[model samples]
Target: MSKMRPSKKELLEGMTPSTVHANEIANVASGELGLEQNDSLTEEEKMRLVCSRFLDIKEDDLMDGDYFFTELDSGKYDEA
Candidate 1:
């Protein structure tokens, strides 16, 4: 049996880059213009709405004052 050759997509695999070049590539891949710190929640109401939207429950359930909410931190998404 013969060994299979690498596909065209694999040509750039394992290519090493200096710290500066790596960061430059990352910037191009990320189309966003602002820095990491600039991407944040500035408004209080917006923050509450955004956080609340993540809940899988129905919107009507949220209206009930007696409903107890528990924040579940599962998987690496929280860290991301």
Candidate 2:
């Protein structure tokens, strides 16, 4: 029997960056942004919220690749 898929809410609620490495945080945020195609409104919203929190930026300003690389190269994470 196939294992049941977790609900979108469950998947989104489970994402967190609290235990990630400093140098790799931005990459994690970038990867989360790529998961935005979940198709469920709740899932997409949760993904954005978690990604924004992970990046330490406002959700309105989250821009995926360019922003993640910029923040990484600018030593922004170093300040945290």
Candidate 3:
């Protein structure tokens, strides 16, 4: 079946933050950043390295946290 082309407005609206993030992920997976090959590292380890180095986040700041936040800077994100 032929696919219908999305309208310009629809295409513009579809370029959301998530879609931009996905594109970045795809670029990384495609090795556009000239990442070195490390076959010994597991996927989780590789992700950790990437997040700490490229995302400018410290290793100590990495933690298990909420995926969605109500007020991130107000300290309510970690409230029980």
Candidate 3 lDDT for residue 22:
62
TM-score winner: 3
In order, candidate lDDTs are 0.55, 0.68, 0.63
lDDT of 3 by residue, 1-80 (tens): 33476796875775767566665545565464344445557889989988787676666776546632435756765658
| Model 1 residue 38 distance off true place after TM-score fit, in angstroms | 6.0
Of candidate 2, the 10-residue stretch with the lowest lDDT total is 34-43
Q: Model 2, range 1-80, lDDT digits (tens) per residue?
A: 23476796875574567753547644567557665544345757878877887776577876789878998999988955
> What are the runs in model 2 whose C-alpha is more than 4 Å off?
1-61
RMSD of candidate 3 to the truth, in angstroms, is 15.1
* Candidates arranged by lDDT, highest first: 2, 3, 1
Candidate 1 vs 3: which has more lDDT: 3
> Taking the tens digit of each residue's C-alpha lDDT, what string does model 1 give over 1-80?
33465785685576766423656655553436443334554568568868788878777666444333223333433566
